[model samples]
Target: MTIWMRCFTGLQEVQKEQSDKLQDMKQFLAFIKKEFVHVIRDRRTLLILFGMPIMQILIFGFALSNEIKNSKIIIVDKADDVASRELISKIDASKYFEVSNERISESEIEPAFQKGKLKIVMVIPAQFNLDLHHSGVSQIQLIADASDPNTANLLVNYVSAIVKDYQSEISVPGIIPYRILPETRMLYNPQLKSAHNFVPGVMALVLMLVCVMMTAITIVREKETGTMEVLLVSPLRPWLVMVAKAVPYLVLSWVNVTTILILSVTVLNLPFNGSLLLLFAESTLFIITCLTLGIFISIMTNSQQVAMLISLMGMLLPTLLFSGFMFPLENMPEVLQWISNIIPARWYYVIVKDIMIKGLGFASLYKETLALVVITLFFFIISIKTFKQRLA
Candidate 1:
């Protein structure tokens, strides 16, 4: 062939190859579209696929932490002397304990403890200063309510550290030898049960995340795949559609919640001191709230992958970090604690812990319950508004 003929042949080959690649691209796009539609058609499978994994992650993260701090502490200064006052100052100065109140007698401790107003009571005996002056070694007793073992142990350690720091600063060769001894006394969970501290928080975080994140992605998958379009084009209103979508997962979540409780109480040997009916009621509300949130997410996002990724990043991370799941809220910076307030999971976690472990009733939990209700309502409103706009 001539040189021109050869160049012409090579150009034709390049054109044909480009055409083939374009055809291949079109086919791949069509395949992806078909798969997306098929997956979206069935809600149950979509929910299970996304929901189960997210639930497991939240549960694992929530259960992994046991740190406690910033517990409310009360001081009963019967001593009313210089040394006792100095010790009280030390307690106040410490980071872990927040001095909520002062009491004059041992009788006042129970009422404050019952009210959940105080976690630790420091008793500075009347002769505390005199003893320090005369005997060189003086003891201050730390009485902690062990109802929450983690808090109790934490309180004792905090008080000891404070007193020790005080002792170190004042210890001089010429000064009066004064040893501030910490006699740590605990009232409730003497051994500081790990199960009691972790179980309630775990149940709340895991169940809520699973129910909400799964339900949201499932709905989004249906929408992206064109199945949701067919459903919407039908006579069924959006509200009824949403309700129907939630019912199955609601039942499944309830079963999962029950299993979690049984395992926590029986296998983990955790205490279930609160009302079972109340716990169930709260759990149900939390699930509903989360499911509503999922629905909202679905209405906003277009693809199941985007929905799933958003939920994992937005919901799971905050639930783990701000819900006091992985880190104690007290240990977090003040800004983070404020940030925790916005997370629905945080309130639910506190509610579950108070109800299941602390045996607190509605009166005590009204604030947390109200907070979740408000958040659920907010998500519902935003989702409804967005969905309606999209439909129009």
Candidate 2:
């Protein structure tokens, strides 16, 4: 207790007094304006600041996922009989396989398989049904592409399940009744690949944190270093200077997004399954919302370190936790789930994932997209009011 008191007393004695109120206030604004101009000049920081969100989105969309689906198959039926026809019908009925090719000649099989046109090929011998009826056995060969284990396994299951169903229905009762089950198509990730499901959400969270932290720290740094005072005395309005500070970062962020997207598709082999334009549009709005959040953090913290800490701890935590990054919103407690409603990253994740992974159009994303826009507007209005109040 004595040691604690001594430390506290020494810290209080060493603390520097604040500058004169009116003069310092004016100088702070000038510094912010000058720092804003320097921010405009440094293009790389600008790019990372602005383009970070898009890069994160692409990284998350393409790099990570939990489900895989939609394998391709080929049918080569020599029998072309009723029983063989019944078997083919069953295979076609399954949603997991796309009938990408059909082959009759033995030579065509090598060519089609070599070209990667088929993941599996089903062959029904000419006398398959005749032999089954008489000998109680039929020969059907399933040639699977062994290169991709996941697709091959799923393809085998689908083909086997379909044929078993047909055999059971025609077989004597109490033996093994087989019936065609209802097709269970995956609504979002039809292919069921893990990358498509996770990348979108990952992208949202990464971009939000990077963009917000970069903007908030940069702004606060100006105030800490005494540059904000020079800019306030210049002719520019506070809002104009703020916008000027923010715009370059926004443009650079978009560029970074493009680079990340190229890497996602070319390097990571992830699919771009939605409108690029809509993706960019929503991304721009989301970036703006994040920048506003940074501005708010800057308003509260005089030190760049504090601004960075605030952005990371305050913004990143809520964005990751409430935005459904680690936990499913549906599975969360009602209170936490409801709280997620206000999280910008959560809304952006839904928008990006729904549009990019699900291939959903504007109509499908309207509600979520609108919520993001509304949130951005709310932040902008609040920050503007707060900034004005600080000046007054």
Candidate 3:
């Protein structure tokens, strides 16, 4: 309390006696303009700044897809009967698995799975068709690369689905009387487009880059070049100096949000089921949150490089991981899920996905919005205190 009081006194008493309204305003604008020029004039950084989004869009939009196609698989069939051949044909037609090779010897299974980059190695027993016809069930062995456990599970599931479909098609009358027919309906994202997930996550990353990285870098730049001291010593209040520093970035970060929204809708066919105004407003809050975070980091570090390292390591990984942007929170261990609650981007992602995909209103998003607000206020207040402490 005393620290803040003394800071306020210095800011008020020192600036008030020497304050000139017109000149101060002019100096603020000039400061902002200089920031703009710094961004525009740096050819390498300018290219990277704009190029990053374009590259991200192109890579995530066109190249990445959730639907797995033509997974490599090897089959070891002891029974090369008509039923076995038909099952193999059905699996091939499903487009999810491609039979790269087949072998009768069980010895070939391990080698094929290891060298062939096979997703699954399936072995059909001798008299598999005869056993299915007489006994109503045929046993098979499936070996999969469990290194990527999720993909391995998916591959097995795909194969299971294909086998079931084939089984239903060839079932004799009265042979499969007891059956539980299951129907699935996917809402919001019926097709389960990868973009439906990636866009929001990428947007979170982009917002982080724009606000946190940029603010931290710029603030540290001024500090490194000794201009931060100059600004603090000037007639302008120190808080006002920081505000001027953030203004240009706030404007540019908004531009980033708008541009991304437009591209997402126009090019990638992004679903905007809720109010655009709400989305932008929430994004604004998140950006401010990141900006405040940047200010906090700047106060702790002396150099731009240090700030960059801190931002990348501290916020970026946590945002990507803890935000459910990559791995799901529900699927994570309970302790990890609890820890994810503190990452600001987790709340932002829920807000973005709700508005963009689920079409939920502010009524559903109040908690998430409140969380972001709380985090932002926490960081903002701390950064302000730090700034005042440094100025004093």
Q: Provide the overall lDDT of each model, using Cα atoms, as 2-decimal numbers.
A: 0.75, 0.74, 0.84
**CA lDDT, candidate 2, residue 67:** 32
Better of 2 and 3 by lDDT: 3
Where in model 3 is the C-alpha error above 4 Å?
1-27, 61-67, 101-104, 172-175, 263-269
lDDT of 1: 0.75
- The stretch of ten residues in a row with the least summed lDDT in candidate 2 is 61-70
Q: If scored against the real structure, what TM-score would every candidate get? A: 0.58, 0.60, 0.86
Q: Please give the RMSD of candidate 3 to the true structure.
A: 7.3
Candidate 2 TM-score over all chains jointly:
0.60
Candidate 1 stretches with Cα past 4 Å from truth are 1-188
Q: Determine the backbone clash count of candidate 2.
A: 34
After superposing candidate 2, which stretches have Cα over 4 Å from the reference?
A: 1-182
* Candidate 2, 129-212: lDDT as tens digits: 898887878888888887988667767877887787787776766544564547678775566565654566656665676568
lDDT of 3 at 371: 90
Q: Which candidate do you rate higher for TM-score, 2 or 3?
A: 3
On TM-score, the candidate that comes out on top is: 3
Sorted on lDDT, highest at the top, how do the candidates line up?
A: 3, 1, 2
